[model samples]
Target: MSQTKLTPPGPKGNFLLGNLQEFQSNPLKFLLNLRKEYGDFVQFRLGPFQKFYFINDPELIKEVLVTKQKSFIKSEDIQTLKTVVGEGLLTSEKEFHRRQRKLIQPSFKRSNILSYGEDMINTTLNYIFKWKNGEERLISEDMLNITLGIISKTMFNMEFKEGADVIGEPMEAVMKLGIKRMRKIVKLPLWVPTKQNRKLKKAIHALDDVLNEIIKKRRACNEKHEDLLGVLMDAKDETDDTHMSDKQLKDELMTIFLAGHETTANALTWTLYLLATHPEVDTKLFDELNNVVGSSLPKPEHFSRLLYTQNIVWEALRLYPPAYVIGREVDEDVVIGDYSLKKGDTVMISQYVMHRDETYFKDPTKFVPERFENDFMKTLPTYAFFPFGGGPRVCIGNHFALMEIVLVLACIVQQYQVTLPDDHHDVKPQPLITLRPKHGISLLIKDR
Candidate 1:
């Protein structure tokens, strides 16, 4: 191991803003350029106060996230998320994160997945019934509605019809404000009663009231159900003999909703967009669906038979991972590879960039589900396609999300062929709390 300190080269930007302006303008494109210009390990500044190192090399990425993970916590960037989600799983650190992850892991096990599958199928079918042949639909919005319904039911064991009316619009408003606050260079104080701040407060209150009422009723009922909330309610961390408090439960519920609902919806939206743009992909997917399910709703038992459908979902994730960037804050002075990472420094890895590297994937930008024929992905290094992240904090719902996507895609594609609307919408990824379509994708829903 080398003992000397060696900094990676990076572009010089404005004296005051450093690289903040470029990153704020277009984070994905900015990061891509940094990789192209600065090689594997690139050092840059966010502002006079913040410094960062970008790790593009897969080997070193493993070192930061897995081999020596204890040396880092989630980047300070996520602290902004605390405003919306509170100190839930995504924002917590160290032993707390570990303990919470353990308590929550049971709900996502393969056994429990079978239970969630029914909810997924029912929710998707309900939403799909609204589409008529040759009708142009806002696919992004529809996906968000469908995912929000599924997650709410699976997590709380309740229908969205009851809470969605009160929670839907406000929750969406808060999310928009939350993303803006999370990325602002000069973030405004929450106490300042500006119009946007007031709007955020209203949004937060609207969601909080609905969630609090639900928690209250659940507590009073004192009965167990097969929902994630029920599991969380009864789970006592034996190490401390303590159960989740009401506040903690709400926080975790919010975190789960954001992680489970929004990310999955964006993934589905991207998958639909990809299928619409590539007619050959559409043909192959329908052929697979026709052979396997044959005009019937996709069931849990049909899981393994829908191999090609699963590949299509994986390809969509590889190209447009909802959380494009995963960031970690250095907790102590540590050596990774040949470089010394000082305490308080931030290191980031872009799943989006690594997934599209020409070195790892042939025709990296194209959507080629066939590339995954016969479990071909196993040949690649782990970091090359880590859409759900890695190590101890990897997304707990990854398996559940994948299952839901494959089943939903198989169900929808088995009956419909989606075509793009003629409005000429400039569809692109908007890097926010999740990578969403900047302008909603419009698609014509037609019988296959």
Candidate 2:
């Protein structure tokens, strides 16, 4: 394989250790500023070893995400996630990934996700019941509990409140550790007795215990529930394999609970915050809701009818994509647009940057849900608006995630009115394994 060297970067820190230190201090700011300086494809080094070519170009992004997908693989950073998430669809490789996706795809079908609508509405309503008129609550944490409950109930058919406290704690702990691990890739091996490593080990074991217990209880039952767990348990691979092992089921369960739950929660939380800050956009969303599903809990089909509401979710994701950056490593030299990408090169495409690029979106800084409804989205390239990613490896839960977000948003809109606290500052984003709100959104809710 020939090496295709990229254009010289603006500057470098050292021959071996490049911009790793600067990139670590502030990833979002660093990427944004780098875009300004380097156009769309900027070259930089990660730590002492890896070379990166940041491609914010939508066409080039599409080339990697769709056209030449097989030439690249999930970057090492995503492999680190397997430490916490295990070898589910997100972490598995090649044929294993294909098999897992085939076995699990049916579980996220429209009918199954729609069946979970009642669970979403009920879980959200339960949370709303706890909100007092004058209280200021951390909206992110609140949504976290609601979505976690919804995912727990809908996926495993477990009584969410029964396992919420136990499962939720370890999940959060592991997420924090995953973040710390990403920031600094220490030289210590996994077995070392470091605080983060110990916590990671404990957190993984705790989650595995919870999942195993759930699987055993389900297996012991006479009747089967038609949720994600049952679907995956019953699903067969293309080879007519019915033997989905307990460990396989456990990993898939962990992946769904982690990916399907918190991501939707973050999206909905950000949507609410965006609504509170932009009253006019809120009014338009309300009008759409009133005209579409007034006073009634939103059904799955109503999701398509709530066009403006869907737009709000899209725009929110555009602004604060839960998965901020996607990374892939090239296995061979390739030409993407005008640039030559070398093998062993790590590349990233930012939904954060592309969504904000003035070239693609008009007034990209403004909150405009209607922008998505136009012919623009129809004509847009594959990578232009990949909130759930694109191509064969696209998030299998795309439909499920969208449905969960829309239903939860509608449920909240119907039952209560919410706003940012009086003294609440504008929210900033922290780009991590997920794009999280820097200062959690604080909200005051009143029953509608």
Candidate 3:
């Protein structure tokens, strides 16, 4: 192998900032434009030192995430995420990640996920039942609240009677701060006592307080439990039969606390927004729900039968995946396609960009649930439609998320007709740690 450097073509930025200003302005558009102007394997600099390779080709993405994964690791952004989530599954590396994932995998098993369906439906009904007919509501907030309630009940077997903001608020602050840290060229240590650092510390402390209390009470109970938390508590490494320590448990719980609800909430929020804007798709979804559920609440058994509903969810995720982009850093010099990426170079694969690529999806910008009606997925490359990502580090809760999205969408759309307010124009994606509505989606709710 030659120790030769072959960099892909990209924008020639100013000597100081590189592409930082453009990226900071709008990351989604910047990446999309990168693909449009520079083709699949594009390289760009953030500041003077940070080199990023944007991979749009499915095969190259497959190489980075699956085949040559050992040559790479989670990107610098995930490192910043460690401040909040600790060394949980999302942020852990190599063997520890494998071990943690293996231990946590069982909790999302089909049987365990099926058991969570009732809680999903009931939780959605509980929150939506409060919406007065003919009243306007921020559907994004509603989705967040309902999904938070569902996660609490299903993961902890505890009902949040007050509201979801208990966890939602702190989590929001932590995520915003985390993104802020990611964007900064010079990141101060968490103990630096700057205003941002202080806010992050305060938010993290609030989360730690909540999570520590949950673990404390659960451990005090001293009985076998069946929820996700219980499963994690009881999970043992088969090699050594070692159980996770309290800190380890708290980290995993925090990961789930954020991943479990926030992503699903955003997915549902976008799904409803899509449904409201696309009345034809909305009508088809309602028809499917009526035929399959028919005034009865959605159950786990109905999951498989609701094809169109599932398509609608899939389509929404394709258009507005909460985890909009995936990033990895090269561990060694590696050749992906024609480019030889050196160690420490960052690779970005954006679902937001790839999902809208004209190559995979026809009329890529349109909302077409029917596009998935046939075996459309089979026609595309494995990495082409990766909303949950692919390879070893793919989201653990993919099944739980899809099922929750379908059941919740079914329960809500079946009972209520969701429409945008007369003055409402559009909701832009915020592109935080998770893709959220920049302006919370406002919808007019009415009885079916």
Candidate 4:
């Protein structure tokens, strides 16, 4: 057997703080540099106590996420998210997680996903029509607001067309607070009365107030609705009468929004940015859309026919995966590659790193939708391009999101021509909870 006890080679940081300061400086650059210097697998310490291992190799990533997945749970980092979204699928552990997943899984099935198609396209086009030609729009905020509305309409039966800020603002505030709190060196207690803490508390209260009202109204209603909430509320297991309580339903709603909202928005934002920068690729996508989905408007039935549009989404996901890293913690002694990991160790597998590695993708940095045209996915390892992660723990919203993204892109492209700023330098990748544009992306559009 390989010496699983051997520690992977890595740089030593300060004895007291370990790598905490270096990590706090610029997480993306630091991690990328570490990979360049130490090769695929590298070990580092967060402080005197906490140890972390970064796995960049795809086959090794599959081993942890798929074959030996039972030995791990979500990383300790997501505990912060649990405070907001509660013990829904995103943070639940062991058998409870599995059970909740089974219950929530049906809402995103093919039939249900197809049912959502009308809402997805109608909502996107309704929002897009508000844009004026020659208007310079902040692409990031627009995408965030629109995707927030999409999730709300699709899941909760809410319409915030004119004022998505009702849901958008508080959620954005709370999410930013969560990300900020996650990076604290010595976290301030909630009762400390700091301005930041006070703001965070306010944000949480505001979000809770909205969620509480939605739950109350839904419970009071007798009429059935064709939305995710309706399915969740009516869901039952024949083996047992167990179903989500109102509070549990609220938790899962928050989890769905938290998981689905900004990530999909960021993804849409990046895809537009990429298309804007690459005119040739943009023309190809528009041509494909014109041929397959022109004037007639896009629906779920068109998903199969829009092959090139779907490929563009795949390539964009490969380039700028919204969830940059998938993190998990060891729950027991586990062997991964040549290293033995004890309980309490954190493991991170980066989609950003692997997707850009020259070893796997030729001309990895270039935008190439053609790469996805072939049976490349079959030839690649399961984890080589895992934007939604892998294994039993993979993101449940994968199919829904893919279909929604393709529909939105196809609908928008069929009628409008997107023009990007000549200088792409300002819109840098900001790795927060999602990979966002640091300065909001500036864009212009005209009806084609």
- C-alpha RMSD for every candidate: 1.7, 2.2, 1.8, 1.9
In terms of lDDT, which candidate is stronger, 2 or 3? 3
Which clashing pairs does model 3 show? Answer: none
lDDT of 2 by residue, 20-104 (tens): 7788888888888889887877888877878888888777888888888877888878877787787988888778888788878
Query: Which 10 successive residues of model 2 have the least lDDT summed?
Result: 1-10
Pick the lDDT winner: 3
TM-score of each: 0.95, 0.94, 0.96, 0.95
Writing each residue's lDDT as its tens digit, candidate 4 over 1-448 gives 6766578988799897788888877777778888899987999998898899999998789888999999999997786677667798899988888888888888888777888888888888888888887777888887877778789888887786533656777787888887788777677777799988898888888998888887788889899988898899988765688888887888888899899988898899899989988889889988888788776888778987888888889899998899998889999989998889999999988888888888889999898999987788888877888999988888889988888888888877887778886654566788877787888798888788
**Model 3 lDDT per residue over 316-376, tens place:** 9999999999999998878888778889999999999999999999999899999998889
TM-score ranking, high to low: 3, 1, 4, 2
* Local accuracy by lDDT, each model: 0.86, 0.80, 0.88, 0.85
Candidate 4's C-alpha runs over 4 A off are 162-166, 188-195, 423-425
Rate residue 261 of model 3 by lDDT.
Answer: 82
Error of 2 at 151 (Å): 0.7
- Candidate 3's TM-score reads 0.96
Q: Write the per-residue lDDT of candidate 1 for residues 387-438, one digit (tens) a residue.
A: 9999998998998999888878877888789988777577899998778899
